[model samples]
Target: MKETPSANKSPPKDDPRIDALIRGYAHLSEQVEVLTEQVKIQKHQVDDLTVDAILAEFHQKQERKTHADSPTPYGRTPPEPAEKEEAPKHLQPEKPHRKRQGLKLAGNIVFYSALVFLIISALFIRTTSNGSPRSLAGFTGMVVLSGSMQAEIPKGSLVIAQQVDPKTLQIGDDITFMANPTTTVTHRIIGIIEDYEDTGQRAFQTQGIMNDEPDAQPVPAVNVVGKVIFHSEVLGQIAGFMGQYWLFILFAAAVVIGLTVILKRIYQKEPKQTAH
Candidate 1:
């Protein structure tokens, strides 16, 4: 008797091509998952940094309040005179020793110099890269003031902007202009309304992606600054932090960079000669 079709059927043999395709698909899926996770992590990090920067800026603008959390300083807050009380004989007061402060002062000076140098270096790099002159050319770096751009350019991020000829700009390009008469704004030029270019001065208007209304009035071309080309979350955070207590931040950063350089030099200079 012949074997029935059902009995004759066996499991299909695995093909090399089919196996390879399956493995490839699995690998691609894993890669996509990993990339997704990395993106999520980076976004979260940027958000946290931005928040910290904003808070730091706010604190700097406001004066420190004297409260339960704040300790009173110096003779500003006079201590109440103690009522007539007997001095404890068991608690003998010891003579105060003169503290050696010169070493610390010297160390602080070196640290401060290093920090200043690092900041200057960073600023120079930024200026050179952004096409801004290093002197007092009325050019300044602006932090992404708001989150209108969101994912493309989040708030609390630093951007280098230089004043430029507005006539050189084209549609769909990002530009910075004054929004109200008082506030400076940075936004993409969605459209350009050509108007009379009287006296070689062209007026341009600006709008934000997240905004419904166009800017109240057109800004003069002179108000247009250089285009933003660079942005960094780290820089934004640092700027925000420094905005609060600039002196403290400057001093701290200098000390950190100075120590780092000194340590690096020491490590590199150590001889690697073999011991007998």
Candidate 2:
């Protein structure tokens, strides 16, 4: 029997699927090239960051050592170093294992700077109320001045509240509301009430958890700011103190500058130690 001519026939010359596949593969190759370049750039950024971390750690360690060796304002020298029993080589603090003090300080500085910026912006920059905070996304931060909500939402706490519907607020939910022209209060909604004074406005009876009795008047729904979602106590205290006292800001700023200067001196001194 004769073998069929089409048995081993080559693919069709005008196969659209093959042409499309080839184009797709080419596009994929281009994407891969772009992605590889991106990865390389990212890798360099990561390397730079790692080096920064290492240098920061080094500076911090040196700062501690320098301070330990520093003389007092009266020219009194620091305490002499006490000789210590040598630990095994593996027990020593490794480069990668050292504390990330520099990074931590940087983070703190950024955090506080942003907090201060937000507070100042809300109070001074915005065209709204005299001291009303500028909202970011749906959240607003307020510095608690009164001690009514002590311990839980302590005085000087930065209460970061998120906007929520008044009707959705349940009893025991901590809420921030404008009590009067001069003050805003962050208290729990103890009971739902009517706003007889403001006909259209809803109201709720609010109280501080630490207070013996609930507030005498109801919080008008129109005055409800938001529900307390989170709070930053430590940062808030620093901000409050600095804000309340103008001179404290200068002192705090000076301290930070002094610390940076000391660290820079220590970093420069590192080369001399290495040579010795």
Candidate 3:
């Protein structure tokens, strides 16, 4: 047979072809590593661009919302805030009822004030007697038990008397005085006896308007109580009536006050109960 190359030749250790093949493989691997690094860099760049775009879009949306919420310019009115919804009628307070309650309270106050006034007036008028007449604010209240003065100061009249100086008392002036230790009398001063009984004190000669003769005793200056100022028959009747029924009136007043307190408490709690 002719000489031929062996089918599986063992290449030499210094073969240029094998060296070139190994060098090419190392260069290809380096190029592949470089391409992978470039792909990673490009991916990072794309991610950053996407994040910036999203951030920009979000900022734009926020700005649009803020602009919409801002007030409008001069020509246009700003949007009004929504009104708070009212509660249902069943849950709402009764205004008319409250108004009625207020009126009732005012009426009660007026009524109580009048009642108190009448009570005080009655007490002042009824308690003043011949034995011990009381004076208040320089004025004495007296209930006339006789018709001595007849037309001027009738029987059963409430008389208001003002204290005056004995020197100021004049003839023809109606006066009240202590006639005795335990008796009081109202009469007219007809004359003044200066230096009566040599006591150096002046005295008044007094007599009833309807009497024919003057009183036997002279009214000394010290016995003079006051000058009669005013008198009223209607007030005397009312005073007499109140004197008899004052205890009953006081009891009724207490009952009314208690009821008012209870009603006020109920009125105050009604709104709280409705709210709950």
Candidate 4:
């Protein structure tokens, strides 16, 4: 049968429904990308604000305490007792100051004792651990004297290195050893360069970052102290701030206590019943 021309007509060149659907999808995808970037920036700003608030609160409290303990602002002295109306000197006592001093001494003792106990426990565990020796011969602390290893190891970092035989060290292994008795160095082993010396013994050299040239001389196995075993981020800060300001430790302790209390309260709270 032959169909009519109207029946054989094609669909419209532009359908409004199809165009609307395509536009909707493109708008949704663009909105999602923009929202994701916004969320990242907001999270970073929140973290920075939180730290700033905490530090500011701590300093403000400290300043208030300092002002309270200070003398009168006007420096006006209290009237002295008249000679005939004098009160007995023995009646007054320095009890308040003595009590405060005693409390401070006790708090300091407790704080130091706790810190020492923690340090001792850590040291004991390290000494008893496997693959670690107790002797200083193969284990010692090395002060970073140069910035050659600035990325991996910065200057002033106390590295605990273990003395290892040169034959045992492999390429890509990070190690610290004495290039000479007077000087020690820590660097990654890029490769082992061996050469026969006049004495017919194998001489080894060490290379490090930021050095335009290889080590001036070979490092003897005997000069090695040990490889780094552990590192503490706080230890360096504490060492650097020794006898300068002790209040930071107290602030840290307070923050920890507050967080612990908050967690406990949250965990102990009863769940609310949802109405049906």
| Leading candidate by TM-score | 3
Which 10 residues in a row give candidate 3 its minimum summed lDDT? 122-131
Per-residue CA lDDT of model 1 for 2-54, tens digit only, reads: 86578667657775787888999999999999999999999999999999999
Report the lDDT tens digits of candidate 4 across residue range 1-25: 9966786776686978888889999
lDDT of 2 by residue, 104-173 (tens): 7788799668656644533431223654555677776778877888879878788877889887888989
Please report how far candidate 3 places residue 40 from its true position, in Å.
Answer: 65
What overall lDDT, based on C-alpha atoms, would model 3 receive against the true structure? 0.84
User: Best by lDDT, which number?
Assistant: 3
Candidate 2 local Cα displacement, residue 120, angstroms: 7.0
> What ranking emerges by lDDT with the best candidate at the front?
3, 2, 1, 4
Candidate lDDT scores, in order, read: 0.66, 0.76, 0.84, 0.61
Q: Write the per-residue lDDT of candidate 3 for residues 56-110, one digit (tens) a residue.
A: 9999777666756886678865554546799999999879988999998999889
Kindly report which residue pairs in candidate 2 clash with one another.
none
Model 3, position 135: C-alpha lDDT score: 74
Question: In model 3, what lDDT does residue 105 have?
Answer: 90
> RMSD of candidate 4 to the true fold?
36.9
How much is the lDDT of residue 257 in candidate 4?
61
TM-score of each: 0.43, 0.44, 0.54, 0.36
Candidate 1 stretches greater than 4 Å from native: 1-139, 180-182, 193-197, 257-276
